[model samples]
Target chain A: MKDIWKKFDETEPSHSSIHHLMAVYHLHKKNGYARGIDIANYLNITRGSVSITLTKLRDKNYLTEDENKFYHLTEQGQQLVNSALSKRHIVKRFFSEVLQLPAEVAELDACKIEHLLSNETGEKLICFMGYYLSEKPEVLNFRLGFRQFKYQCQSVAECRLCESDCFFSGKEISKTG
Target chain B: MKDIWKKFDETEPSHSSIHHLMAVYHLHKKNGYARGIDIANYLNITRGSVSITLTKLRDKNYLTEDENKFYHLTEQGQQLVNSALSKRHIVKRFFSEVLQLPAEVAELDACKIEHLLSNETGEKLICFMGYYLSEKPEVLNFRLGFRQFKYQCQSVAECRLCESDCFFSGKEISKTG
Candidate 1:
C-alpha cells in the first residue's frame, strides 16, 4: 500500500501555526502559565512575533491571558496541546527508531512530519511500530544504526553492523576517507 | 515534565522550502519520478515555483533530474525521506495511542508535532509509550477517556462499542450500546 505520507502531502499545514501550538503546549506543561517573552527566549524568536501569536491564540480560546503577562491553556487549548504532544512523540520515534536518522535530523524531521499525517494512517503506523518493536527487535536495532554510527570509530564498522541484518543488503556503504 | 512544544512559539520554517519538499516527496512517491509539472499539480502550486524548487533540491543532492521531466531521490535525498517517514509514524502514534485523540485530530496534530521534538526526548517518549502501552493498559484506557472527553464526546462508549472492560470501572461489557 502507498504510504500515508504520500496521500496527505497535498494538504500540508502552515508551519507558523504548528510552531505556535507547540510553544503553547510546552509552556503550559513547564509551568501552568507561560509568558510571551519566555517563549521567545526558548524558541530563539523575537518577542514581538511571540506577542502577536499569543494574542491570536488567546482570541482563538486556546489560551487565557492574565495581568502578569502569563498565558495558560484553556480546556479547549489543553485538548489541542495534548494532541500536539502525542504527535511529537510519534514523530520522534519514527526518526530515531524506524529510519535510524541522526539525532538532530530525526528530531527536526519529526517536528515536520507530525503535522502531515492522517489520523487513521497515523494510528496504523503506531500499531505497526509497536508490533514490530515487540516482534522484531532486530528491525529496531537496524533502523537505529544511524544513531549508533555517530559513536562508532569507523563508518564501515557502523555499516557492517547494520548490514549484517538490514533489509537493504545490496546497497554498499561507500567509505568517506 | 515540561512538554517540548513550548520551545517554538514564534519560530517558523521557510515556507517555500517546506512546501517544495512536501510536493517533491509526494510526487516522487507516487510516480517513482517527478517533474516540475507533476509537483505543481499535486501541490496546487505554480510550475515556475516547482522548477525553482527542483533546481534547488538537485543542487543540494536531494534530487536527480533528466530530460524526460522525471526526477529521483539521490542517496542523500532518500536518507531525508526515510528519516521523515520514520518520524511521521512516531508522531502519529503519540497522538492516537498515548493521547487517545480521535483519529482525525491526532493525525492532524501528529503532522505538526513531528517537526518540533528533540531526538533525546523523542526516544524517551517512545520508550515510555512502549512500556505504558504494554504494562498498564488500564491506565492508558483512562487516558483515552480523557482524550474522548477533550474531543467533545460524551463518553468512551460514544466513540466505540466496548468489548472489554469500561474505562471508568474496568468491568466487562454486557451490551453493544
Candidate 2:
C-alpha cells in the first residue's frame, strides 16, 4: 500500500490549524457548540487570529458558521479531529500508563505528537502499550529504572549503575565504542 | 518535573528549522562537512531559504557558518541531532520489526515522529520493543491482527470483526460511549 500522502510534504496541516481544530472540537464537546471568540479564549489567542484561521478552515470546507454564528465542523473536519483525538488518547495513555509520566506531562507530550505520528506508528504504539500495561507487573521498578536511566544515560563513558545485561550499559557501548 | 517546554506554545523549533538541522547533520555525517548550497540542493529548497534558516540556527547556537560558508553544528546541535536520530532509530525499528510496516513507510513515519515524542516515552517504547521482540512468538499473528484492525477501525459503528478480547473493540468503547 503506497501512501504518498503519508509524507504530508505539501498537504501537511499547519500546526496552528490543527491546534485550533482541536480547540474547537473540545469547545463543542463542552458547550455543545463553538464560536470564534470561544476558540480564541480557549486557546488563549486573539479573536482576530481565530477568525482568520476559521475563515481559512471554512474555505477549505473543514467547518461552517451556522445562522447563530456558532461554529461546526464539516464531516471532513470531524474526521480530522476524530483521528487526532484518538491518536492523542493513545499517546497520552502510553505515557501515563506505561511510562508513569504525570498526566499533565503526558497530555502535553501527546498533544505535540498526535499530529506527527503516522497512523500505523500510532496503532503499533497503542497496541504495544495495551500489551505492556496489561501484562507487566513491575510498574514501580520501571519507574525507578526511568530515574536511573535519566541519570545514567548522560554519557557513554560515565554510566555507573546499569547492569551488564542492560541494553544501554556503558560496557555495551564501550565494546562498540 | 514540570516541563514547560513540552507545550511548545513558544520556543519550539519550526518544522523547517528542524529539517535543516537534520539535513546539516546528515550531510556532515556522510561527507564530513556541510555547506549552504549543498543543503539547499539536498532539501530541494531555495538557497535563499536555506540561508535564512541557517542564520536562525546559528543565532540559536545550534550551528555555525564559517567564512568559507560551510556549516557545522555546535555541541548543542550535535546533541539535538543525536537524540533525534536515536528516537528515529527506535520508532523505525518498532514500525518495521514489530508492526510489519514496509521499510520506507517506517522510515518516513520515524522521521515525522522523531521531533515530537518526549524522550521518556521514547525510552519506554524502545524498552518495550526490546522485550517484545526478544520474548514474543505471536508477532506474525499480531501483524495480521493489525491488518484486520486497519480494516475494522474505520468507523466506531459496524466494527464486529474484532474479538471481545480486543481493547479497541466497539464493546469497549460503548462502555464509555
- Clashes per candidate (backbone, < 3 Å): 27, 0
| Best-matching candidate per lDDT | 2
What would the per-residue lDDT of candidate 2 be over residues A67-149, giving only the tens digit for each residue?
Answer: 98898888878767766666777778866765567787688877776766665555565554444343233433343343333
Candidate 2 Cα deviation (angstroms), residue A141: 15
Scored on chain A only, each candidate's TM-score is: 0.64, 0.70
Candidate-wise lDDT, in order:
0.51, 0.63
Q: Clashing pairs in model 2? A: none
The positional error of residue A34 in candidate 2, measured at the CA in angstroms, is 1.6
Per-residue error (Å), model 1, residue A27: 4.6
Best by TM-score: 2
DockQ of each: 0.08, 0.22
Provide the lDDT at A34 for model 2: 95
